[model samples]
Target: MLGKTASDNRVFVYEVAGVRQNTDNDKNSYPFRSSSSVFIKVPYQRMNDEMRRITRMGGTILSIKPWTSNNGSGEQSNDGD
Candidate 1:
């Protein structure tokens, strides 16, 4: 299970399956600042489906990265978002 914390201190869980850098930096500065790692967050249940899609698209699943908040306790409320 995942825990929630403050906005800045919140850890984002993502999968670094594959990445494509934007080389068209000359067109805009957005590409340069955004041309690092790609983090996509999906629900836990959808992980399997996402993995299948990535594999089908010829991308390799690197690893499952889970980030836990430092200040967050191991308690999460399921009151619906």
Candidate 2:
């Protein structure tokens, strides 16, 4: 969970789209299809950095919200864009 601190207890989820594998990605030892959307668990403190990184990677940020369960059935608060 991101953004879990002594004072702040909120965790965030980042919904990213159009992330393609590049040379920077070491996981791509072989060819594979890129998923259109990716769900990233980001902490509040690192949100800005993560957003910047995502942008540099040519990914679009669809939405950002508070962390919920794996199924995303928990409460959702759109605190980040």
Candidate 3:
């Protein structure tokens, strides 16, 4: 993990809905199909590939957004003014 900074890691959150379970995806065992939308975390490198895969499995992406799970204990702190 040398020379790796926090900014170097790229991740995205995909809010997808209407995922259809079919033969091709059945083999892959995608068990996130439901009536509601699901959150899928995709790396930057596999963004396009994952999108294609989802589409192939009959999924509609509701939205795509850059995500980072640094909500607490990151670099920000509240100093009493």
Candidate 4:
């Protein structure tokens, strides 16, 4: 999965295997920031579908981050970057 942060600070996660579309406000219900741009995750299988759905809904993807699993396992944060 891929995660993107919109201008409104709302994060959207997608399967990275879909399409991107452009449509009106017919399927939009949530509030999104005005300066939103679509970010896509490539090198995946069938990512066009997810991209299309997000664009059609009038939302933009900002970034993509690696997915992690937190099953109550204690983890440490490293700030050595």
Better of 1 and 4 by lDDT: 1
Please count the clashing residue pairs in each candidate, in the order shown: 0, 2, 0, 15
* Better model by lDDT: candidate 1 vs candidate 2: 2
Which lDDT tens digits does candidate 1 get at residues 4-68? Answer: 64543433344444444333224433433232334444455556665564465445655566455
Q: Pick the candidate with the highest TM-score.
A: 3
User: TM-score for all predictions?
Assistant: 0.39, 0.63, 0.67, 0.32
Q: Which whole-number lDDT from 0 to 100 does residue 19 have in model 1?
A: 41
- Candidate 1 RMSD to the real structure: 10.5
lDDT of 2 by residue, 1-81 (tens): 566465265577788888766654445444433677877777676778888877877889999876756646433233453
Candidates 1 and 4 compared by TM-score, better number: 1
**Candidate 3 global lDDT:** 0.65
Q: How far is 65's C-alpha from truth in model 4 (Å)?
A: 1.4
lDDT of each: 0.44, 0.66, 0.65, 0.38
Best by lDDT: 2
> Which 10-residue window in model 2 sums to the lowest lDDT?
72-81
Worst 10 residues of 1 by lDDT: 72-81
